[model samples]
Target: MLPNIEIIVGTYEEFLLGYQLKQQSEEDGDQVVLKQTFADKSHAGSLKCVAVQGPWIASGGSDDRIFVYDMRTRKQSQILLSHSGTINSLVFSPDLTHLLSGSADGHMIATRVGSWKTEGDWQKAHAGAAVTHVSCHPSSKLALSLGGDQVLHTWNLVKGRVAYKTNLKSKSTLGSAPDCLCWSPDGEHFTLSGPLVVEIWEIKKAGVARREKTPAKPICVAWLNGRVCLAGLENGSIVWISLDAPEDEAAKNISAHEVRIKAMSYFDGTLVTASSAGELKIWSCDIEKQELEHLTSTNIGCRPTCMALLDLSSFKSECPQTSKVVAPKHTNQEKSNVVAAPKPRGVVTIEFEQDENPTIEDDDNSTTSDDTDSAKKSKTNHKKLKQDEESVGQSDDDDCEKSDDSIADFSDSESFGTDGFSNDSDSNQRPAQRKRRNPTPVGAKKAKPKQAKKE
Candidate 1:
C-alpha cells in the first residue's frame, strides 16, 4: 500500500521541477521520484518558497510573483503580483483564510484566499530590512515578522500596522541577529534563533512579554510535542528543548545527519529531517526517553529547501486514485502502512562486520581474573539496567516540573520598556561568538589541486 499522505519538497529549480517522496514494494524499498518536473513557461524564475492548503498549492519565486495552482485541476489558478524583490517566504494563516508572503525588499504582501486580493497595508511591512520569516499567530488576528534589522516586529492584522517591535541586538550581539523565527503552537510564545542562541518570548496583550535564552544555533525549528520544540542545528543535529527547563538543561541534542539540516517537520510520532546534501531521514521519536530511533533514509537527488506533509486521510475525498495519477511502477507501493525500517541500501547506510572473539591464553606470569569479582560486576550491571528501565518515565516527569518552575521564575523577574533598542558604539561591541558552518559537507569531493607553478 502507498502512504495515504505524501511529502512535497521544494528545490532551487523553477516550479514543479523537483521530487515527491514514495515507497516501493515490500521487497524493493522506499524512494523519492523526480515526478513533478513540468512547469508553465509563463513562470519565469527559480522558486524560493511554497505552501499548500487543501487543493491549492502556492509558490513564490525570484521573479517576484506568487503562483497558485489547483491540484485537482492541475492548472495555475492565479498569479499574484506587487512585490519588488525575490519572494522568500509564503505562509498561509492558521485559519486558512489568508496568505502572507515576505520578500527580499523588506515588504510583506497579505492576500485573502477567497478573493485573492491584497489586505490593506500589509504590503510594505519591515521597511527597514529584508524580512526573513513571517509567522501567523494562532488567533488569526496578529502576525510576526523577523527581519535583517535584528528586530522582532509584530503586526495587528486587523489594523494593518506594526503593533509593537523589540530590538534583540542588545540581548545578543550586533550582526548576530536571528535569521529564523517560529510561533509556538498555542501562539502564546515565539522563538528566535540565529548564531549560538535561541530565545523564546512570551506573547503578551500589550508591549512585550518575558524572554528566555538557550545556547544552541538552530537552522530550523518546529514544535515537536507538548512543551517541546525541536531545533535543527548546523552540525546536522536535532535538539528537543523544553520551554520551561533551565537554559542549560533545556536541550537534548541528537546528532541526526552528516550535512547541514535545511528543513524539518513533525507529525504524529515521526519526525522528518532533510539535509542540504540531498539526504532525507525519518525517525520514530520517543518523547519519554528524549531519543530518536532511525527509521529510514532516502536521497532525493536535489538540495531540498522546504517541505510539508498533508495527511491523506483528511483529503481522501479530493485525492484522485493515486495509483492512476502516479503510475504504480513509478511510485513506490508498500505492502502495508508499517513504520519503515532502515534498509540495507541508502545514501548514508553503514555496514559493520563482526569477527570471532579473540581467545586469550593466560600464562603463569600473566594476571589472573577473579571469578568472585566477575560475579559481582555482573550483578551490578543487572541492577543498573533495572534502575534505568524504572527511571525513564519518572525522569521525564521530573524534568517537566523543573522546566515549568524555571520558566515561571523568568516571567516574574523580567521587564521590558518601550525604548529598548541598543545604541552602543563600535568600541562597545562584543567579540564574535559564533560562525556559520561550511556550505559543503565533510568528505565531499574537492576540486583537483591546481598544477604546481613551473620551476
Candidate 2:
C-alpha cells in the first residue's frame, strides 16, 4: 500500500492539518513518518470536531456551521447551516447515505449525503441539551447518542425517529455521564467512559456487560479488528480493553506520549493518534498480541482537538471523485432503505461535480430581471452566467440533479423514513418541489393564451 494513500486530517487550534504516514525502511528502526500535507486555518474559530467517510470530509467549529469537502478535488463542496449552536459531533452512517450532526443546541439531525437535504431530525434530540457524541450500529439502522442531560438516545435510521432513550443520571453507577461514547467494530456492544472508568454495555440488552477502572483518566476510545478497544488517556498513556475475553480487560497499559491523547482512529491494524500537544503519531498494531509499535511522530505548531483518517485505498478508481450532477426531479421508481457492513463504500455513489449550469440565483450578488420587461423574459437570466449553453437550466444527465444550494429541501411528510434512508432515487421523492422549472428554449417567445374570436 502507498504510504501517502491514506491522509490524516486533524483540527489544530483554528487550522486544519493533513498528514500522510510513510513506513520507514526496516534498517532505520522501522519507524512510521508523519508528513505534513497542509496546515492552514480552516475555520473562523477553534474547530471542535470533524467526521470522515470515503472521499467526504466535514469540519465544524465555534463558527456554528459545517463545511463539506471533496478530498479528490480538495475543494469546498457544500455549507450546512441548520444548527444554531456550536457544532459538537458529526457521524456518517455505515452506508454513506446518512450524515448525523449534533450541536450545542441539543439537536441531532440526519441528512442525506447526495442530496444534502435534511432527512429526519429530533428537534429536542437531547431535550435541548448539547449532544456530546453519536455512534451508529454497523447495520446502519440504529444509532446511539449521548447528550449533556446525562441521557442516551437510540435512533432508528430507517424511520428517522427516536427508538428509545436511557437516562444515565438516574440509573448508571458512574455517578456522572461519560464524556465519550464509542461502538465496537461489531454491533454486539459499546463503551462509555469518563475519568477513571470504562464500562462496556451490551447493545441488544442496553445493560452494562462489565466495567473496568482505568489506571489513568481515559480521554477517548477506538476499537480494532472487532476484538479490542484502545482508550487514550489524559496521562498520555493507552489502556487496552479486551472484548474477546472479558476477564482480560486492561491486560496491557502502555505509555504512548508525553501529553494527553485527545483523539485516535484505527483502520486495518494501523492507528493514528492526535494529542493536546499538537503532535501526531503513527503506529502498527499486532491485534492478537495487543501491541502497538511506534513508527514516527511529528508536531505541527498548535494543539489539535480532534482527528479522522481518510482511506484512499477505496478510491483507487480512475476518477476518484467522479463528479455527479443534480438536476430537476423527474418520474422514477422509488428505492428501498440503506444497507451496510462497515467498509469504505460509504461514498461510492456520492458525486461532487461543479454545477455546469449555475444560475444567477446561486450567486449572492446577482439580481433578477423580474420587473425589467416581460419581453426580456425569453432572454438569458443574467450576463456572464457560468452555465452550460447546451443545457440551460436543464440536467445533462438523465438522473435528477439540482443545484448545490438546491440539493436539500425539507418535505412536510409525516414520516421521515421515506426521506431519510429510502433507496428510492431522489427524482421519485421530489414530486411536490416547485423551486426549479425548465426554462423555455432560447429565442422562443412566450406564447399568449388563446381567446375566442366569435364574440
Candidate 3:
C-alpha cells in the first residue's frame, strides 16, 4: 500500500517541489504527481537543505534564509533569517516543538515552533568551523554534529551546549569526518559514512561497535531498521549493510543510479533515493527479508540538493511541545578549544547562566558517620536560628520600655528661649534672623557689615 505522505525536494534551481503518490484505477496503477511548487517567492539563491515535520515544511537556501511552508494550507507561512551563511542542515525535534538549524557559519540555533521564536542557540557551535551535518537522537534530549574541525560534538539538547567532544580522526582507520551522520531509531547507535567505509558507533560507551568497508564511496545514508542501513554510494549504487552480519560477509548492493546519489530518506518501509542527475525513485524496503523492491520513480527535471519526507498520515493537530528552553550552562570545562560563542540575550535567547559561586555536591565516598554529623550540624544551625529569633524578640520589648522612659525624662526637662526665661511655649518662639557673613579662614577677623559703613 502506498503511504499517505509527500516528499519535498530542494533544488539548485531555487525551486521547492512537493510530490505525492496518487492512486488511480487498478488498470492504471498508482502515479506520482507534483502537488506544489514554490519558486522565487522564497530566496534568490539555491536551496541547500530541507526538513519536514508535523504540518510544516522548511527549506534552507544558500542565501542564509529558511522559508517555512504550511503543507496543510499550501502557502508560505514564515521565513527565518537566523543563519549568516549557507544553511547546511535543518531538523525538527521528535516532540515537534523546536526546529534545529546548522549552518556554514558554525552556528547551531534552535527555534521554537509555535511562536516561531529562537529559544536558545549555540552561538559558535563549531568554534568558528562550519557544521557539516547534525542528527538528533530519537529521545530528542541529545544530538550529534560533525564540523570542519574534524570533531564530533555530542550536544545536550536540554542544556543547549556541547556535552562531549570526540575527534573523528582519533582512530587511524576513521581519520576524516563523514559525509553523513544518522542516529538509529533505537538511539543505541549512529551510522557515519566515509569514503568506502561505514562506521556504527555505540552510544553506550561512545565507541565504534562496527566498521565495514563498502565497494564504493558512500555519498548519503538512511537507516532502514535498527540494524540495517542503506548507503547510497558515490558510484550511483545503493548498498544494504547489516551490522548484525559478520565483517567478511558481503552485504546486498544494487546499482540505484547511473550517476552519483545526492540524498536519501526512509519512512515506514518506504525508501526514497535521489540522484545528482535529477531522478527520484521510491522503493519498498523489507529489512526483515533483506529485500528491496523498486516501487515507482519520478523525474523532477532539475537537480536537487536535498529532500525530506512529510508523512501526512502522521500529522498531528497538536504535537507535544518541549517543556522549556534551557539556557546555556558554562563550566570550567567550557574553556576547551571546542567551545563556541557565548549565551544569547534576546530573540535568539540564552537568558540563564551558571552561578558564579556554585555549590559542590557531597562526595559519594563520604562515610555514614560524616553524613550523620552533617545532619546534626544542620539541626544545630536551625536551633540556633530559633534561639536568636527569641532573644531578639525579648530585647525588642525591653528596648521599647527603655525608649518610653527616655522620652518621659526628656519631656520633664525645662526649655529656655532667647528671652532668657524658662518658657513652656516652644511653638510661639521664632528663630532669630541671621546676617550674611564672609567665608574666611579661621583666626581671621570677619568683615564689618555694609550697614555700619552707611551709618
List, residue by residue over 1-455, the lDDT tens digit for candidate 2.
Answer: 43345554556458777887766767746656667766656578888888888788888888888888777766777889988888889888888998899999988988889789997778788888898788888889999999888888888887888888888886555557677688787888888886688888886676987777887778888888565788899989888887667575445787898889999888876787878887778888888777898866788777888888887765543435557888865444422333436866332222223554323333333233333234254345553354565465454442244553444443434434553544455756644333443456799999899998996
- Superposed Cα deviation of residue 295, candidate 2 (Å): 0.7
Off by over 4 Å in 1: 1-3, 15-43, 173-175, 204-216, 244-250, 316-455
TM-score of 2: 0.66
Top candidate by lDDT: 3
> How much lDDT does each candidate structure score?
0.68, 0.75, 0.79
Per-residue CA lDDT of model 3 for 158-205, tens digit only, reads 878889898877665655766678888888989886767888889776
What is candidate 3's CA lDDT for residue 415? 64
Q: In model 3, how many backbone clashes occur?
A: 0
lDDT of 2 at 395: 49
Give the Cα-based TM-score of candidate 3 against the true structure. Answer: 0.66
Sorted on lDDT, best first, the list reads 3, 2, 1
lDDT tens digits by residue: candidate 1, 156-233? 987878898878778553245576577787777777765766656665644223233334457888777547778888
List runs of model 3 lying over 4 Å from the truth.
Answer: 26-41, 316-455
